[model samples]
Target: MELERAVGTYLRHVALERGLSEHTVAAYRRDLDVYVEWLRARGIVDAEAVTPELVADFGAERASAEPPPAASSLARMQSSVRGLHRFLVREGRAETDPSGRLRPPKTPRRLPKALTIAQVDDLLDAAGPAPGSEDASAAQPASVRDRALLELLYATGARVSEIVQLDVDDVAQGDLLRVRGKGDKERVVPVGSYARAALDAYLTRVRPALAAKGRATPRLFLGVRGAPLSRQSTWLIIQAAAEGAGLTAHVSPHTLRHSFATHLLQGGADVRVVQELLGHASVATTQIYTHVSVDALRDVYATSHPRAR
Candidate 1:
């Protein structure tokens, strides 16, 4: 089979059948483009012409390129190539997977940065007036909505993409939120009181006003123009709150997620339970929070132990 045709088939399979997000599919496409071009340069346009040696050379060439790529980027690129060849072989379009022996470089394990509880409090406060305050009633529709957005982010430990994708009906179940996560997987997460109150305020008090400004939509969160809240807009909402709270550290939506998981683990929530709440397909992904908790314990021991240090 023509290598280009096989690549096209694999991309479509991943996007349509595997249900990968557009962003993820686009990354795979980019890496495959590079791989295809390199193969064409070597006068190899058929899938059967590919060899393990050629694939290994390609990996070495990418690894040794001037101004080297980050380990994660290199790994992802290699995975993209490997996935393509494997798919071709599995589909019987190729006799064997030439990229089988190609291995991604090991990436450094970086711990997620989580905010202290007080800092989260400050950030949430900066999002809007307190839920019961006189100012809460007077707060702008956007302010009420921003507060609800931040509160929900920490409450659910969901990805920003999942939060922005929520619809009005998705939150209708009292004290429970139906979150659609990666690959369209749905999970029910319990909503805390603070987030529920903020959501109620947004839904009853603010959302109707924002909804009136544009064409009818079922989206739970809306912009000043009443369009569905976008992921970029959601990020800006977090950034503005971080600035308002005088938080020096870089903050993003994932920071709230990390804090949610770390705090839960510190509070003695089981890692498997956290995994379920987080919609993590594997508990191994949730175990990283245990490391963050251990580090916190070490900090306390170093400070409180009188004979230490």
Candidate 2:
């Protein structure tokens, strides 16, 4: 089969049959586009014409490119190419997989950055007054919504993409929130009292007014113009609040997620339970937070102990 056609077929398979998310599929498309172009440049346009040496060469070239890509990026690109060839072989489009011997470079495991409890409080307060505060009733609609948005992000430790894609109906179950994560997988995460109260204020006091500004949307978070809040918008909201709080640390949507996981582990929540809340397919992914907790312990011990340094 032609390499381009095989890539198109594999992309469709992952998007439709395998139930991968649009974002993941788009990434695959991008990586494969580069791969196909590289092959075509070498007069190798057919799937069967690809060789393991050629695939290895491509990996080496990418690794040595000007301003070389990050290890995670190279690994993802390799996975994309590997998946394509494997799919082609399985479907009888090719006799052998060219990427069989192609191994992704190992990326360094960087511990996630999590804010302290006091810092989280400061960030949330910077978003707006809490739901029951004396000035809460007089806050702007956007401010009210920001408070709820940040609160939910920290409370649930959900990916910002998942949070932004949420619909009003997803939270209709009172204390339980039905979150649709990557691959359209659904998980029920409990909403804490603080987030619930913040949400209540947004839903009752702010959402209605915002919804009336534009066409009706079932989306839980809306922009000032009333469209569903986008991931970029959510990032901006987090940045604005971080700045208002006078925080010097870099903060993003994922920072709240990291903080949520770290705080839970520090408070003695089981790692397996945290794994479930995080919707990680494997507990290994969730265990990284344990390292973050251990680091915190080391820091405390270093400062508090009377032993020689």
Q: Across residues 1-309, which tens digit of lDDT does each residue of candidate 2 receive?
A: 998888999999999898888889999999999999999999999989999999999999999999999999999999999999999889888888989899899999999999999999999999999988999989988899999999999999999989999999998999999998877789999999999999999999999999999898899999999899999999999999999999998999999999999999999899999999999999999999999988668878999999928
Worst 10 residues of 1 by lDDT: 292-301
Model 1 spans > 4 angstroms off: 299-309
Q: Rate the local accuracy (lDDT) of all candidates.
A: 0.93, 0.94
Task: Report the C-alpha lDDT of model 1 over 179-201, residue by residue, as the tens digit.
Answer: 98778788999999999999999
Best by TM-score: 2
Q: CA lDDT of 241 in candidate 2? A: 99
In candidate 1 the C-alpha lDDT for residue 33 amounts to: 93
**Best by the lDDT measure:** 2
